[model samples]
Target: MPARYCQDSPDAIASCVLEDMVLLYHRPSGQTHMAIAPVPEILATLDDGAALTAGELLGQLAQLYDLGEPEEALPLVEAHLAELAALGLVRIA
Candidate 1:
């Protein structure tokens, strides 16, 4: 889904930081999720109200974080997106 524009699901998700992890509450689904590091980073990036593809997100992440190699980070970004999407915290456009 790298080429697809992805955005956070507004109104359905709420988040708070808990130590090293972020606790996400999906109001609509009544589900709670715990995320660390890149998960919270991805959410914060999308929280800007901008829709971006996985590659674009990876670029933003690279600027804000030291994710070793860009090539390796792509899959990691995709994985985070998948997890967020599954939890109703992100949507593809």
Candidate 2:
């Protein structure tokens, strides 16, 4: 399943995410929130653009997975990111 996640980077970044759908969330408080949705739903939100990175997706995945630090989240994110990339939901660059 496309997992829910949350992350707070030292510097806020904008990105997009998809599991079942596409969603968008910016680090308003340097914190990013995310959840799983459908690809079409996400595409609707992405009418503005295509392509999303881990930081762009919004839900509660990071927290859901217990990924705490960039050091920690990096690996976990890499795993999920690869999963998303495989599904064509995200691009690493």
Candidate 3:
């Protein structure tokens, strides 16, 4: 099976939109992250607490945004998920 990712916890982070940026405050780490575009959208998609593969996430996002080609977006989504995982914002499940 492909790797699956889930957000750390709904309570672990607090977020708000400022202009075009999404500001995320991670309570556990007391750190804030500024995100743009699909980062914020990715976090929001994970907010439902579903563990999803990059392909699954791309499908969900495709419903809400015109991401062009899924083939192109898959790697980008995977990269974003990996980055989020490294930041402790998300975890592999």
Candidate 4:
């Protein structure tokens, strides 16, 4: 299954950065979520207002960070996308 997602606005979610860790607050839900490293980067990529497929997201992320094999990272990326969706930070498109 290919997962795709996008963010409407930065204001919809508030984020704080502490070194590699990022704290994300979902304003509508009034819930706070924590992310680190590639997680934050992944959100930022989607926050650009473009719905991206999991493969596209992985390709973009690979450019920024060294991700081994796409086959190896696909499952991991999908898992992260699921976590992001669970947080209400992203949605399936």
What's the candidate order when arranged by decreasing TM-score? 3, 4, 1, 2
Identify the runs in model 3 with alpha carbons over 4 angstroms from their true place: none
Off by over 4 Å in 4: none
lDDT minimum window of 10 residues, candidate 1 = 1-10
lDDT by residue for model 4 over 1-93, one digit each (tens)? 666787757688889998778999999889988888778888889988889988999999999889999999988988888888887888887
**Candidate 3 backbone collisions, by pair:** none
Residues 1-93 of candidate 3 have per-residue lDDT tens digits of 899999867899899999999999989889999999999899889999999999999999999999999999899999999999999999999
Q: Which candidate do you rate higher for TM-score, 1 or 3?
A: 3
Q: Give the per-residue lDDT of model 1 (tens digit) for 1-93.
A: 355545545566788988898898878788899888888788788887788888899898889789989889898888878877777788776
User: Compared to the true structure, candidate 3 yields what TM-score?
Assistant: 0.96
Q: Report the C-alpha lDDT of model 2 over 1-93, residue by residue, as the tens digit.
A: 334332333223354655453344444544344545333333333334434444444233443344456665555554665654454444343
Give each prediction's root-mean-square deviation over alpha carbons. Answer: 1.8, 12.8, 0.7, 1.4
Of the pair 2 and 3, which is ahead by TM-score? 3
Question: For model 1, what is the C-alpha lDDT against the true structure?
Answer: 0.80
Instruction: After the best TM-score superposition of candidate 3, give how far the Cα of residue 85 lies from its true spot, in angstroms.
Output: 0.3
- Output the number of the lDDT-best candidate: 3
